[model samples]
Target: MLMALSAPALAHPHSFIDMQTTLVMQQKNLLALKMVWTMDEITSADLLYDAGSAGAGSEIWKKLAAEVMARVMAQHYFTNVYRDGKPLRYMRLPSEYQLSRNGNKAVLEFVIPLAQPAPLAGKPIIFSTYDPSYFVDMTYKSDRALHLPAEATPACALSLFTPKPNASMQAYALSLDKADAPPEEMDLGQQFAQKVTLQCQ
Candidate 1:
């Protein structure tokens, strides 16, 4: 049963990403989150090679971008925002989105708005990024990856939490195959996710 249960959790995470996120605020209210993701060299190389084969400035890039965005949308942009321990819903798709390449790396940028903007004057909030299926590992570039507005900086403090998976968990994650579908009851990726918290005065 353990092996059967772990089967689905073990299949996935074929890609890696380094992510940077900014908390957008308006008049002390949380408005949206701006995200920048840079894909690893091998994946980036594959994408660029494909793009080149399709021809420069070809429509294939556009189609690829659309497909990528569609997959991300299906996963709620791989984001989870919370206030007081309750999850916050997304109002809609990103206001702005683009896919591009910087040398050998593929980059993705977008902004996701909250369903209902929350006041940041007196409370705290948390956000995290992870692929539920564990098919992609999303990691912050550094401690400075989470940015806050100038005004919010005075009253708000930012903290990052990177979960360290134990040896057993690591082995379990390593056992997963890229083609495996995640089990509905298991959120294996979350166990190894990085979280950003904004605490306000």
Candidate 2:
């Protein structure tokens, strides 16, 4: 009998930031999202998000937020209702709202607000992302490593900039695939229960 050891990569859930998407009625005509990354310095960042027909921060922001948040939070997460970089409220898992850019090439070193599920806390979320209209590839490296076709690899992954006044949000859709699965899922519920038990001990 032959024993197979390694599993395929695509079989695992891709990791993207588990963020709560929401909207803000700020004076500026912009759209934005907030989420913490394992990297303290986001050398580059951008939202390959949608810009509905209206373009940029048009009536499209709210509409897209609602749509995207649903996809992200389907696994059980919530959106944070914020205003001008401060916490204003908390929307249930899968909240939607407007987005705005406060800075560029920003470096953020904050703690995650919520504790991850039993085995997910203190781990990293690998954001394997891609979009047709907008691209946000910060590394700007070849796609061979990611097992993607050269053409499929995004050229503008790091195109971090605020949306224009009359710009419509990118019409691209968002997909979230958890990166940490096999190694973690081995004993997920059990590991989580052990963590709780250890905490009480």
Question: Top model by TM-score, which number?
Answer: 1
Per-residue lDDT of model 2, residues 1-201, tens digit only:
000111123322112221221111122211223332221112123232233234446565545445444543542322232233344322344222343323332122112222222211122212222211111111212222122223323421111121122222111112212233223233222211100000000
The backbone clash count of each candidate, in order, is 4, 33
Candidate 1 local lDDT, residue 15: 71
| Pairs of residues at least 3 apart in sequence or in different chains that clash in candidate 1 | 10-176, 11-177, 12-177, 13-135
What candidate 1 gets wrong by more than 4 Å, as runs, is 1-12, 53-61, 179-182
TM-score of candidate 1 to 2 decimals: 0.85
CA lDDT of each prediction against the hidden true structure: 0.76, 0.24
Runs in model 2 deviating more than 4 A are 1-49, 52-56, 78-96, 100-184, 187-201
1-201 in candidate 1: lDDT tens per residue?
A: 111112123344667788999888998788999999888776676567666755434587776666667777877888889888899888668887777777777777889998888888655788999876666778996778889888888988889988888998887877767465557577888888888988887
